[model samples]
Target: MSIDITANDFLMGGGIKAARFDTIGTTVGGPITTQPKVEQQKDLDTGELKFWNDGKPMMQMVVTVQTSLRDPEVPDDDGQRAFYIKANSLKAVREAVRRSGAKGLDIGGTLTLTYTGDGEQKARGKNPPKLYSATYQPPAQAAANEFLNGGQQPAAVPQQAAYAPPAAPQPPAPAPAAPTAPAAPWTPPPGMTPEQAAAVAALPPEQRAALGFA
Candidate 1:
C-alpha cells in the first residue's frame, strides 16, 4: 500500500479549469484510422529547447481520429479517439482537406475539427493559455436534393506538406470569417457506428455509389 502523487493531485478534478483545448469532433468510429507518424515532441518547451539544440527532438504529426465525443472522459462507445498532433495540428488537417473539395486527405472522411478561440496566446502574460485554432471540415457533398443524405465518404487521405521552397509573399491577411459549426455535439449523418454502419456497408458498389451511399 503505497501511493503518492503531487501537483495537488491534479487539482482533484473539480472541473471548471478551461484552457486545455483540442477536443472538437466529427469522426464517429470510422475512417482515417491512421496516417502521419513522425513523432517525438517532448513537452516542457521541447525539453528546454532540446538542450541547446543538440538533441533535436521536436517533431509532430500523429493524426488518428474516431469521433463521437460525449466524452465523460472518453469511455469508448465508439467515440473520442483523438490525436491530430502539431504542425499547427497538421495544418488544420490540411486545410480541412482543401475545404472538402478534396484532392487528398480522406479515409472515411467527414473531418470538421474546430476550436478557434481566435488563437494566438502561446505565451505572453497573465493567464496565457489559448492557442485554439484547428477548424478543418472536409467531407460533405450530397445535395442533389439530398437523397436521404449519405454525404461524406472519401477515405484514405493524408499526404500533403512537402513541396515548400517559395518563401516570400507575406501580406495577405484579410479573409477569415465563415467557419462556425463545431460547438461539439456530433454524431449525425445517418449517425453511423454500427461499427460505422458496417464500415459503410463494406464499401463497394461504385464505392458505395461514390460516397452518397447508394
Candidate 2:
C-alpha cells in the first residue's frame, strides 16, 4: 500500500497569520480554503486567553484564505501564506458575501477586505477603531458553449455592423440653362429704300437727325 502526501500538507504546519488592518487603505484577500468559526480571543500583550466580566470567554471568528501577497516586513519569506479574518472585519465579509447573492462564504471563492478609515473615538485617551469594507467574488460559472460542445471551445462569432440612419436625399441638380441665339445685325426699316438707308448711314449723326433718319 502507498500513501500520498503533498507540499501543501507540510506548509499548513507553519500556521496562518491573522490579517492586519493597522493603516487606512490596507487591503488583503485571496481564495478561501476554510469556513468561518468562532474561537476564543487571546490577549495580545500577555499571550494569555481573555474572558468577559461575566466569566464567558471573548470570542472572534477565524477564516483561512490562501494568498500570494507577501508582507513588506517579511519580504524574504517565500512559503505558502494564509490569513485569518476576525471581529468586525468578519461582519463586513459576511455582508459582502450576502450582497453578492451567496448563501454564505464558501471555499474556492475570493474575499477581499480593505481598511477604509477610522471610526469615531468612543472615549478619552483611546484611539478610534479601524473601519473596513469587503468585496466577494464567487467562482466563475461554466459558459453555455462549453456545455453544448461537451467541454470543447466553440468558434468565434463574427461581429455585425452597427445600425446607422440613411443619409438625407440630395437636391436634384439645377437644369442646364437653355441655349441662347445671337442677335441679327441691324437692318433697314420697312418702307425705307436701301439706297436712302445707305445715304443715312454715310451721313454725320447731326445730318441724319435733321433728315429724320437717326
Candidate 3:
C-alpha cells in the first residue's frame, strides 16, 4: 500500500527542494511500466505522448491520470489539482516526492496533502495520486479457429461394433415309479411225480408174484 501523508507529515518528512510540471503530457513511445503524470488535452501533445499513431484513437491520451483510493474507479481531475497547487502550497507533496527517492510521483500513487484528520481542513472528496497507467491493447492477433485449434489436430474414431456376452439356460427333472402290493400266505404239496409212482407200482407187482397179493 502507498503511504499517504498529510501536509504536516510532509513538513516533518523534510521541506521541499524543487519540482517540475509540463504544459502537456509525456510522449508514449513503446510500452511504459509505470509513471507519474496528470491528464489534460494539452498534456497529450506534450513531450510524453510517444509512439504516436494517428489512426488508433481511444488509445491515445493527453496523459494517464492516477487515482486516489477513494476514487480508484474514476480518476478525479488530479491534473487540474496539480495545476492549481501553487508554489508555496505544493511544498509538502514536493518534499514527499523527494523523500520517496523516486524520479517522479504518479497520480494516486503517493502524495502529501495540505490537510489533517482533526484539523479544520475537511477532505474535499480526496486528492488523487500523482501517477497512473493505461493499457493499449493491439488488436486481436489470432482468429477464433486459431484459438480453438491452437496447434493440434482432431482425433480418429472406429467404425466397427462392440462384442457382448451370451445368456445362460435351465435344467429338467426325473419321473417317479409305481408302488407294489404285499403277497398272501401259501402251502406246498408233499406227493411225488407220476414217473416215481409208476416205478413203485411195477416193483410192487414183482414182489407180489413172489409173496402173496401186492
Candidate 3 runs further than 4 Å off: 1-83, 116-214
What's the CA RMSD for each of the models? 21.7, 37.1, 51.1
Is candidate 2 or 3 superior in TM-score?
2
List, residue by residue over 65-157, the lDDT tens digit for candidate 1. 555445566354445354535656466666666665657544444444445444555667744332333434323331221223445443433
TM-score-superior candidate, 1 or 3: 1
Consecutive 10-residue window with the lowest summed lDDT within model 2: 140-149
Candidate 2 residue-wise lDDT at 37: 48
Give candidate 1's TM-score: 0.22
| Every model's TM-score | 0.22, 0.53, 0.19
lDDT of 3 by residue, 1-214 (tens): 1333343532232221122332223222221113322221213346442333673322211112222223244354232222223223244445544555544444323232332212233367743333422222111111112222344332222235787644445434436666666533211112422432233334334342232212
Specify the highest-TM-score model's number. 2
What TM-score quantifies how close candidate 2 is to the native fold? Answer: 0.53
| Candidate 1 whole-model C-alpha lDDT, 0 to 1 | 0.44
